[model samples]
Target: MKSFLVGIVLGLFAFKCISSLYVKVLKPQSTKTGPERALLVAPGAYIKGEAYEPLGLQIRETCDFQLWVVLLLDFFDNIVNPLQLGEAVNKAIQSLKDEGFTDGSPVFLAGHSLGGTMVAMHGKNHYKDLSGVLLYAAYLTKGNKLSDYPVPVLTLSGDLDGLTRITRIMDTFQELYEDVSSNMKAKYRTPVLVMEGVNHGQFASGKMPSNVAEHDLPPDVTNVTAYQKIARYTCSFISNIASSSALSQQVLDEGFNTTFRLLEPLARVKALETNGFSHWTELAQKYIIELQNKTQISVRGIEENGQMIKFEFLFPKAEVHNSAVAITTYSLVTYPLDPFDVTLNPLSPIQIQAKMLSQERAKHVLPNGRYGAGNITCKDINQLSILEAFQNSSDVARERFSKRGRQIYLDEDQIVESSVQWQATQLRLSDGSDGLHVSSIKYKLPFDPIQESKSGLFYCALLSPFRAMEWIYVDSMRLKS
Candidate 1:
């Protein structure tokens, strides 16, 4: 027992010596140019600043910003207490100032995961001189108040990040937005970009944890592609901040709009990748055909009048009825080119209006097995309700539904073959056209089957829920003019 104790003590001492040597030998280095803006990046736990060398180089190549990579002492010290890491970063920043980094130029702080949280904490104290804060897969600790920070913040996270829950981050962002003063909110819009299908570690092109399997990690584009996307957004945000003349109300509004416009394509592509549609052509024919067949609408043509493109489709009439209950549904699905093909003209309008002719026939059955015709009206599905449903569904299930048009049955429902009547539904584009690439189909409940339980037709309605028409596969050439 005495010998074992000595061996354990010797092992710990050796590890400490090795770690101290590594820190001294591989201290963080700065990519110094005579650029006005400076970016100080803090690395995550058990990670060295060298891991982010490629990303740093990419950012510098794209923008006129100096990059400073700050190395912390060791993994244990940084993880157990981030204050030491923060102090090391402060020292690095001070060194850069001494090396002719002028106060006239702005400084931006950025980090990934735990490093992100560290910078957020550090920025709260050093907010006066910071142009902005950029966080990738940021994990917030208890009592961390992002609302107190005065600088603009841009947080990027992946949906498949096993380490951090995106919903919680979204909640925190909302709270921060609400807690800020109206004036501050106007100046610094706290934008959170949640990249679909990206995992926690992929944000940085570094050695990932060995315990995580490659297949279990979120699907990503090539490493170069992923880093390029991140770098572009980071450079754009910092550039906007450095170039802005004032935080006046009008300037703030314009700045926010411009920022979102630049970010729209990046967000759209990320969503498309998440839904298993990586390239533009892969999403072209199948997706367009699915929408047409599901809605039972034939595309008339696409008319381009200057900057606006008008799409016209024909909506056919249909009737559905049962002994005690009947319902008629009408819908139209539209697919525009912007979200799928970002290279297209940015001047394209976000939404194109569609005109649909709707008709409904509803009937109620009597207790004596007699059909009773009743007047019924079709109403649009609530947008909030659809959003709630999407949020409630699992990520994998949602991706399958989006990519393959597969329907997800409720947990209580048995996995037996089921049939549902197809209906014509209209697709409305929301304000933000970020995720509008996917086809949107809607079905209206013509009658409340639950209310008609006394009529003995409840089981029949329940078995066959409302759905779009069965799609018939057609040659891709048929869709062309």
Candidate 2:
């Protein structure tokens, strides 16, 4: 009898594993059957920055407008090749309209890193009818407004992200939307979401971990566990917004009514620690009760472009503030292109004899500890010089690279000397092992080497050595501007 019970348990485990794998492979197959009610604009993985092949092809097969995922790497591929970003956006937008998905049906735009930023942009400019927006380590372009929001937006990021440092970006988004539309700004609305323990790359389930090189551990952090709970709640909020036309009113009423009606659940917070529930859901249901008790909080107008956009939150301050404990804020702004600069010349790809070279002129002990080349340029300086701006500050450089790297100059040994050429520019890399070899990096704003400044959604694309060259093609080659 014991052996039989053991066999039954093992069989069940096997069934679960097989079922999980089957669902994973067939998940994308959702597009095969008919006109989808929802559309997904997915960001490209590390390889294909803007490869819309899956979505394009999926539309041809399954007419179901159920979901759309747009790959961002290609949509914003200005880092490696600054030509394809605009084209990707245009094509994706056109694809949505062309599919005959006009009104009522919800559209979802989601991307990781650069892809996520594009989703934000798309939702801001187009997709007025979208149900929700989800971003992972994404950046927001300045001047774009997301206020008077027709749909809810969920921006997720790991607290410990070293590369993207998206915390600042989230703050900027919250501030920017405060006054863009008086009607859209939330008086008591919380826009920023902080996911504890999640690294920048863990937005999806089962994908390879971005930090796998250093740590062979499972993905779990106290904060991330908290974040996971929040994610479910946020997704549900967004899904509901997309599902209903009177979403704004309904969400507000439901949220407000629940605040007072569910006080008993909030009172059991301490008991939760002793009783040890089966899942976090039990805890979350209690938290929802806490939200239902607050009658309302009034939020005044928000400042935007030096002007105020008025709106009010009816929930009480204590309830709203408590709700925002996991979230934080930042600031963002935009400046227009200078029209007086008539000498603006578009950067044409140059044929570069790719030889890695670092700054040999180290006359004194540098603060950043390493002597690196000024921005590597093919020929003329243009907007593609953003890589230089994101370099570790001299202080950070000295600790991590200068002293540790042990070489006299920074990035001196890591340079690869080879003949590398863009369409019109020739790239001069640092020729040594210490020199950083960038696989892929995408930013929203055009780099201005001449001005010596960088801005917008900056992303680094990391891939295995085998997939390096494929990165070029997967990142679309079209230029929109």
Candidate 3:
């Protein structure tokens, strides 16, 4: 009788453990009502759904977004039956919809550790109605690469994700990135963020000491800072995807900046591979955390709409403590270049530009978690302001400019205005706290030319006084007469 009783107690414990993990769906406990957006999260293997509670709560406190986590009991879980998994996800989604979350609301899926893999598999297998996928501390198999994901995908992981190494992250991201078309690349550059001192388990809630999947390495970042960074990046990426705004092609240019130097790492896939990821992660743990800086800025993109050329610049902020440098001036400059098929230059390499887009000179200096925008227009007869001329260090680039300048009696050293009409305005989607201001400024150019001759390059040139001179290649002004 004693032995039978012991067996019953053991069985009860086993059932409780299974109950904690068996794909149970949980809504964040804060709100009785639904939110503007709904997020479904998956926790790592052997970890309960509660492991992701803190992330959900942190996200909930800032934005009106609902967070849910599901735990599936499997050993080293893989998305072998994605169709079945998709159905399970749909169940939770339907529950949200029933709670008045509705069909109009945007639904996002995030996964941590194995859960991260689940998110990718969902995207790969059935990306039907999803807005976007956020993979936290997750790596994708070649079979799971999101080459066909129609929406914006963020493959963010930590440098210290002991189980899901950054090397795998980079290798898989490059694989997926290169497979997409140029148009997709132009639209969504597939932003990747690797926070310093962060590891796999933190994306979920607690220490997760026994979850051996997350290598038992010491994370140097504090909980407040870590969650703040995760929530911040997640929000920004979602905002970008939802608005369908281009984050500037700065990553490909010489001046793209991220905390990890991914601006260049995106192209140099083999650099980290030379040494194992542990070496890289150990170094990244030493990086400092801050609140505000214009980490990314460039010409958003150039598009032709009827009689005008729409030119927009993307101004994105980074996490920091305070802002020291206030207003940075950027001159919107352009010069002619040859079309892709034929190699020819316009007669004059006249770098035409409108007046500089300067910040309002605020006390806080473009504060943390905010963007500034303003606009103005220039007519041909009103006389457009010459901010600065374009300069190329390459001998081949300089030779092309010099030859073209001589053909049209243009000065290589001066900013010359051609007969181009310009108009600028802005439409901002504002969201912030701490009484910070959000600014919107969009610059536009009418399809007016001295005459339509050849293709050109548009630039958001950081014309001096604040920092070193840098050219942000906005877009190739591929004109169609």
- TM-scores, all models, native as reference: 0.46, 0.33, 0.44
What tens-digit string does per-residue lDDT give for candidate 1 at 194-224?
Answer: 5555666666555664422321234445666
Off by over 4 Å in 1: 1-35, 66-73, 77-80, 97-100, 103-105, 126-131, 139-147, 172-189, 210-216, 245-481
User: What is candidate 2's lDDT per residue for 323-426, written digit by digit as tens?
Assistant: 22111111111122434311111111111111111111111111222323343322111112222211312232223332333121111112222211111121
Question: Going through the candidates in order, what is the number of backbone clashes in each?
Answer: 7, 87, 12
Q: Could you give candidate 3's per-residue lDDT for residues 1-481 as a string of tens digits? A: 9999999998886554443333444554466344456667766656656666667667655443454433433322322234345655666676766665557667777777666766777776566767788877765555443555665677776644555554455555555445544444522435556666566677766547454432333455776677877876776666555553333233222111343353233223223112212111111111111212434222111111122243233221212134333212223333234232111222111222222222222212333334423221122111111111223122322343333311111111222233132223221112122111212222322222342111111112111210000111100111111
Candidate 3, residue 6: how far the Cα is off, in Å: 31
Better of 1 and 2 by TM-score: 1
Q: Rank the candidate models, highest lDDT first.
A: 1, 3, 2
Order the numbered candidates by TM-score, best leading.
Answer: 1, 3, 2
Which candidate do you rate higher for lDDT, 1 or 2? Answer: 1
- The 10-residue segment of model 1 with minimum total lDDT is 469-478
State, as a TM-score between 0 and 1, how close model 2 is to the true structure: 0.33
Best by TM-score: 1
Task: Show where candidate 3 strays beyond 4 Å.
Answer: 1-35, 64-84, 143-145, 173-189, 207-214, 245-256, 259-481
Residue 254 error for model 3, in Å?
A: 14
